[model samples]
Structure formats: structure tokens, C-alpha cells
Target: MNASTFTTRFRAAMMPTVPSPLAMLSHGKGARVWDVEGTEYLDFLGGIAVNALGHAHPVFTRAVSAQAERLAHISNYFASEPELALAERLTRLTGGDAVYFTNSGTEAIEAAVKLARRTGRPRILSLTGSFHGRTMGALSLTGKPVLQDPFRPLLPGVEQIAPTIAALEKALADDVAALVVEPIQGEAGVVDLPDGYLAAARELTSRHGALLILDEIQTGIGRTGDWFVYQAEGVLPPGAAPDAVALAKGLGGGFPIGALVGFGAAAQLLQPGQHGSTYGGNPLATAVAGAVLAEIEDAGLVANAALRGAELRAAIAGMASPLVAELSGRGLLIGVVLTRPVAKEIVAAAQERGLIVNAAAESRVRLAPPLIIGDAEVAEFTEKFAAALAAVAASTPTGATA
Candidate 1:
């Protein structure tokens, strides 16, 4: 079926808040996908950074099937090997001592909020342009007014500060329970927080006894050239480790999973019965996460992510198109800034050329391809991206930039 037909059917079947379905995706392999009508496209969005190992990796599929055959899920009252192993591994990776599993990124944020509140402090601080999640508690922490305005009277005591050291230091108060910041603002047009600002936040939070929470839902799981974005030396400054970290997106390698890792004293905040999820650490999901981690280690995708990410950025920069103003973000998560507010036009043009990209803002085009993307895909993407730019420039008004 065509996209229009699928959109019509989907609109009738699903809730109205969801935007129109882009396409009736039939199947995907590696870094490419096909729509229901069999039209092919290179998938740069990577399921919005959730496909860590890309589509249908053999190890991932095998692990899921094997775990399904043995067992699927049990209540939080019961313990499972996969769940335990995955939690242990994640904690080790993040320099944390404890973990709480959830079904998605938003749930992870919600759990983190509750953990922060347990400190008895009533206020939480987040950076402006932050996108934690859509749930009421997570929405309360999000800095975007458009998302929070509709959900008015959100959980109280959450305030936003700028992504700068001065703003953070000025806004911090004794009543603050935690300061949540994304190392790289993915939804806010791939904006990266200054390293010194992060360092200042750590020092100040330490002094004020407020927990530091890093939201790595988009930048984690090797998406940003590191196991976790904070793992990269110099990203968070010396002696700077967040008290709590929320993770999801690519953690399960496509299976639904998320985790909140608490370090030091914050680890003991959430005791038994304080928080839980029905499918948080289900055997199936945890098994897939374990396999995803194993695959990343064995195949050296983390290093590959670093290498390819640099190459992608350099190539785009070398294009030297006047319409291409700049590029933001690291690793597979990138944003191409246009000289004007032509991101929507560029995205449509790229789609017409069988390349999938997202318009993160009016002038920002975001690309979050799979970590496994390589030279051939990069070359093809660059060529198509240039073509998309040419298409835009040709049709744009003579006085305006594409």
C-alpha cells in the first residue's frame, strides 16, 4: 500500500495526537529499509537512535529467540539470570553501584525523578531545551515550553536553567534535589553542552548536596562514540560523575528496555517497594540487551562508531555548500544546519531521493543512523545529501538561501 493509504488506516486505528505515519515500513536490514510499496531508503534515523546494532543483527535475533524459548517474563517478585547480568554489566559500565529497569526512556526518567525526590529536597533543575520524556514527571523536567504548556500544572518544583555555567550556578539553590542535563541535547537540534558548564554543575551540585543526573537516553549505548557519552574523557571534566544516569533507546538493541543507574549514595535511595515495573527487566528484554552489549564488545562497534562518526562529520563539512551552515552533534547523531529555515524542504527533498533524515528544528536537520554504518553508506549518504541541497537551492527564492 502507499503511504497515504497507510496514514488513513493508521489515523483511524491510533490516537489523534500522533503525527501522520511517515510510511508503512515493511522491513529493514542493516542501515536500509523498505516501505510497504517496496520503495527502498537508507535509514539514517536508526529508529530515532534505538537500533544500536542496526536492523536484524544475527546475534540479536538469535538471543531473542533463544530467550523466548526458555522463558519470557516474571513479576518483579521473581529474579532472572538475564536481568541480573544485564544490571551488573550496566552498573560496571557507568561506574554506578545500582540499577532500576524500565520499559522505555520516559519511564527511566520518571524513576530518576522519584529517586531524586527521595533526598527530601523539593526542587529539581534542568537545562533549557531539554527533552527528557512526555510523561507528567518527565515532562516537568523537560525545558521545552511547547511540550509542557499543554500539560499544565505539571509536577511542581521543576525549573529550567540555561546550558551555561553562569546560568546553572545562578539558578542552583539549597532546596534543589537534582540537576538533570543531557550531555548532548538530541531533540534540541543536536546542541552540545559546554564541558566547563558540566564541570561547574558537578562542583556546585556537590557543594549544595544536590544530585547530578545525566540523561543519556539518546547519547548512550555507543551512539555517541562512547559506551556512555559521559564515559568520554574531558566531556564531564575531572572528578565529574553524575549521581544518577537514565538510559534507554539503544540499550536493548531494538527490544524495549531502559535503566536508571545511581552512583555512590544515590544508589541506596530507592529501596525495595519504592519503585517497580511489570516488564522492566523481563527475561526477553534483558537477554537481548546482554547480547547487544556482547556484540558491541566483540565486534568493536564502539570504536567503529567513533571512526565513522568523525568521517561523516568531516565529509559533510568538506562539501562546502553555502546552504550548509554547520553540523552539530557527535558520532552517528548529527545535525546539519541550513543557512535558512529550509529544513523541512531539505528533509522532503532528501526523502524524495531515498535518504531519510529528520528536521530537528526549522533550520536544523538531524541524522541518527545506526552505529554499524560504514564507508559505503557514508559515501552514498553524502552524495544524496548534496543532491538534496542542490534540489533545494534550485527551487528556493533567488534572494533566500536554501
Candidate 2:
């Protein structure tokens, strides 16, 4: 069926929780996708940073198929080889001692919430401009009110503070269980934390006897040119590591998977019968994630993400457009700040020009293209993005600000 027919069916059958369909995508390969009508577009958004290897990667395909044929689901009662291997890999990558798998990023956050609760402390602290997830526990920890207001009476003992050392120092105490933070706040216009903020947070949280959890759902799995942002140089001081980390998005590439890795004493937070998931660590999902991570390592895509990201940033800056305010974020994750609140307009213009991007906020356009993108993808992106910016600038009135 055509995209229009699917759209009609979608609106009729689906709940109104989210907006109507943009386009009914048919298939994708690498960083490009096609609609039902066979129109192609460059997928700069990369499924909101979930498609680390892009769509339909050979490694992903082979892993899923082969694993399905061998062993798909054995439940938590029986341990699988893939599950154990993936767990070992994740713990090693994050320098953690243990792992708990889940089905999505929010689930990982939920697990983290439980871990914090196990500390026997009264409160959990997050930043004001943070976005953790939408589940009750994760949503409660999320700083934005718009997303949390509807679901009032959310999990108690959760509070938010400004993303600064001063704010954290004032808010933290012996009563606080954990402080959850993102290395780079993806949902908040891809905002980065202040320099040395993580290190200082580590010191303060340690002194206060609180767990410092890093939510790397969007920034982990080589998205920021490192296995995880905490491992990135200058992000955290030497020998400093988060007590626990929440991971998802790119972990299974395009597949659905999430994990919580805990370090030191935090690793033993969840005792038996405290929490469980029916399909959390299934063999199929673990096998796919294991393959995806391995391919990312073998292909040196982490280095590619770092190099290509730098090149893309340079090229965008070279445009020197009056509308361009500045660039935020690092590696494949990028945010284009505009002088005016025309991010939605820019997104529409780019879509019309056969490119895909996301308006992270009123004045910010986010780009998270596939990690495998090379010079060709970067060139195409800059050309189309330049045109889109020009189109928006031409349409907007002067002296506009947001």
C-alpha cells in the first residue's frame, strides 16, 4: 500500500499519544531510507541515534538470522552463551562488575531507579534540562514538567536541580540515594555539561555517600567516538568512573536492547526477586547486540565517528551562514543552533529536499547520522543542509529571535 493509505490506517487504528505519521518508510540501507512511494532521503536523524550501524547492516542481518536458527528465547531460567558473552563484553567496556539487561532505554533507567532505591536513601536528584525516559520511575527523574505533568503523583523522592557543581553540591546530602545525569543531554537540545562537572560530581557524590549514575542511553556505544562518554578523555578525571551506567539506543544497533552496568558495591544492589524481565536477556537480542558491538570495534567505526564528526563540524562552520548560531554536541551526535526559532521550519525544508533531521528544540536541529557514514554522506548532508538553512532564512522575517 502507498504511504497515504498507511497513514490513514495508522491514524484510525493507533492511539493519539504521538503525532501523525511523517512518511511511511518502506526500507533503509546505510544512512538512507525510502518511502512507500520509493522516494529516497538521507537519514541524518539515524532513528533518533538508535541506528548506530544504520539500517540493514550485513552483520546485524546475519547475527539475527543465525541466532534465530540456533537459539532464540530460553527465558531467564536457562542461561545462554550469547547472553553471558554480551554481559562480559558490556561490563568490560564500561569497567563495571555486573550487568542487567532490559528491552529499552527506559527499562534501563527503571533498573537504575531500583538500584538507587536499594541504597536506602530518601531522594534521587536529576538536572533541570534532562530527559531520562517516559516510564513512571524514569519520567519522575526526567526534569521536564511538560512530559511529567500529565502523569502526576509520579514516583516520589525524585528532585531536579540545575546542571552545575554549585547546584549539585547544595542539593546533595546523606539523604540522597543517587544523582542521575547524562554526559551530554540529548533530549535537551544536545546540551553538554560544564567542564569537569562529572569529576566534581564524582567527588561530591562520593563524599555524600551517593551513587553517581551516568545515563548514556544516547551517548554510549561509540556515538561520541568512545564506547561510552564517561570513557572519553577529559570527560571524567583519571581513575574516576560512574557508580552505574544506563545504556541503550545504539547497543543493539537497530535492534531493541538496553542494559544497566553497575560498578563496585553498586553491582550487588538488585537482589534476587527484586526485579526481573521476561525477555530482557533473551539469546536472540544478546546475540544481535554482541555482533553489532563487535562489528563496531572491528570496523574502527569509533575512530571514524570521531574523524567524520570533526570534518562535518568544520564544513558546517565553513558555511558561515548568518542564521547559524553555533554547533553543540560531539562525534556523530550534533546539534545545529539557529539564531531564530525556525528549527521546525528548517526540518520541513530539509525533508522536502530529501534529507532527514530532527528539531530537538525551538532553535536547535539535531543530527545523528549512521556511524558508518564517510565523506560521501557528509558531503551530501552539508549540501542539503545548506539549502534547507537558506530556505528557512529566506522565509523568516528579520529581527526574529527565540
Candidate 3:
């Protein structure tokens, strides 16, 4: 069907949380997708940075199919080998002592919040412009009030702090149980943390006896060249780490899954019956995640992401298109800020030319292509992007800064 029909049918019944169009995905492979109209587009969005190994990856297909045949789910009342294996892998890779799986990123954040509050502290600190999730609890931590205005009186004691030392000192206190911060604020048009920000936040929270919860929902799972941006940025000390980490988006290679990892002292915070899920770590999702992680190593996808990421960013920046105001982000997660507010036009133009990109903000065009994107695709997208920017510049209102 077309965008109009899809929107008309779904928007009426669905909760209007996200302004999503009903352009149904017919199929996807590698870094591209075909809509129901059979129109193919280069998928730079990558399912909002969730398709880590790209669409329909062989490893993901095989692992999920094979696990489905053996067993689907048996709940937490019983144990599954794949689930245990996935947990061990995450703990080993992340150095977290334990993990709690959820069905999506919002749920993972909820678990982390619970872990922080389990210590009897009630306050939480989060950064401005950060997009945590739409859940009521997570929504309280999100800085954007647009998402929270309709659902007022969110969880009490949630504080939104300006990304400044002065603000942290003023707002957070010993009674604060957690400080959640995104390594790179993706939905804030791919904003990166200032140098020494995360480290100082970690220290301040520790001093106050509050847990430092790193929200890696977007920047984890090899999206930032490294497994997690915190590792590459050197935020964690030799022995110290975040009390807990929330992960999702790219963890399962498009197979839905999220994780809350509690490390060291934080591990025992969530005791039995404190938190559980029916399909969080079921065989299919864990098997897929485990397979994707293994395949990323075997196929050298992580290294490829580093190399290709650099190349892609350089190409986007080098164009020096008049409309492009700035280029930001690490690894495959890059954002191009425009001189004017024509993000909708740019996105629509790119779509018409069989390219897919996302308008993250009024003047920011974010590019989160698949990890397996080749040089040819990069070149193709760059050319189309330049043209799209030119068109936006020519037709839109005159320049104003991003």
C-alpha cells in the first residue's frame, strides 16, 4: 500500500506516541529494504540503529531458525542453555557480574531504575535532550517534556540535569540512587558527551552513594566501532565501572531483545522475584544475539564497522555541501546538521530517489547505515545526499545555524 493508506488505517487505532508511517516493509536484505509498493531504498536508518549485522543476515537467520525448532521458551521457572550462554557472554564481554534480559530498550531502562531504587534511594539524574524511552518510568528520566506533558506526574524524584558540573552539583545528592546518561545522545541529533563528562559524572555519583547507570541502548553492541562507546571513550576506570548498563537496539540484530547488566555490587541488587520476564531471554532471541555476536567476530564485522565508519563520515563531511553545517558521531552512527530546517524535505527527497535517511531534529539529518554497507553503497548515498541537501538549500528558507 501507499503511505496515505497505511497512515490512515494505523494512526486511527494506534497510540500516537511516535509519528510513524504505515509504509509496511515487504522484505530486507543486507542494507536495503523493499516497501509494500516494491520500491527499494538503501536503509541508512537500519531500523533505528537496531540492525547491527544488517537485514536478513545469514547468521541471525540460521541461529533463530535452528533454536525455534529445538525450543522456543520455557519461562524463568526453567533454565535454557542458550540463555545462560548469552548471559555469560554479556558478563564476560561487559565485565558485569549479572544480566537481566527484557523485550526492548525501555524495559531494560525500567529494570535499571528498579536496581538503583532497590538500594532505598529515590532520586535519579539524567541529562538534557536525552531520549530514554516512552515508558512512564523511563519517560521521567527523558529530558524532552513533549513526551511527558500528556503523561504528567511521572515517577517522583526524577531530575533532569543540564550537562554541566554546576548543575550536577546542584541537583544530585546522596539520596540519589542513580544517574543515567547516554554515552552518545543519539536522538538529540547524535550529540556526543563533552570530554571528561562521563568520568566526572561517574565519580560524583559514586561519591554520593548513587549508582552510575550508563544507558548504552544506542551506543552499545559494536555500533560505535567498539562494543560500547564507554570503552572507547575511556569513561570507566581500571577497576570502576557503571553500577548498571542498559542495552538494546543492536543487541539482537533486529530480533527484539534488551538487557540490564548489573556489575559487582549492583549484581545482587535485584534478587529473585524482584524482576523477571516471560520472553526476555527466550531461546530464539538469545540464540540470535549469541549468533550475531559470534558472527561479528568471525566475519570481522566489528573491524569493518570501524573502517567503513571512518570512510562514511569522511565522505559526508568532505562533500562540504552548503547545507551541511556539521558532521558528528562515531563509527557508523553519524549525523549531518543542516544550515536550515528542511529535515523533512531532505528525508522525503532521499526516499524518492530510493535512499533512506532519518531527520533526527529540525536541522539534523542522521545516518545510521548497516554495518555491512559497502563502498559502493557509501558512494551512492553520498551523491544522493549531496543532491538532497542542495535541493533543501535551494527551496527552503535562508540559513540559520543548527
**Local accuracy by lDDT, each model:** 0.89, 0.93, 0.86
How far off is residue 3 in model 3, in Å?
4.3
Better of 2 and 3 by lDDT: 2
Candidate 2 lDDT score at position 219: 95
Which candidate tops lDDT?
2
- Estimate the TM-score of every prediction: 0.98, 0.99, 0.96
- Candidate 3 stretches with Cα past 4 Å from truth are 2-4, 11-17, 20-22, 399-401
Number of the candidate with higher TM-score, 1 or 2: 2
CA shift of 373, model 1, Å: 0.9
lDDT of 2 by residue, 1-402 (tens): 786799789989999888877888999999999998898999999999999999999999999999999999988888999999999999888899999999999999999999999999989999998999999999999999999999999998999999998998899999999999998999988998999899889999999999999999999999988888889888787998999999999999988999999999999999999999999999999999999999999999999999999998999998887788999898999988889999999999999999999999999989999999998999999999999988888889969986
- How accurate locally is residue 10 in candidate 3, as Cα lDDT from 0 to 100? 81
Taking the tens digit of each residue's C-alpha lDDT, what string does model 1 give over 1-402? 777788889989998987886778899899999998998999898889999888988988999999999999997889999999999999888889899999999999999999988999999999889999999999999999999998799998899888889888788888999999898999988987875767788889999999999999999988888888777887677656899999999898899999999999999999888888888899999999999988888999888888988998898888787788888888888989888788888889998999999988888889999888988999999999989988987888756753
User: Worst 10-residue stretch by lDDT in candidate 3?
Assistant: 393-402
Provide the global lDDT of candidate 3 against the true structure: 0.86
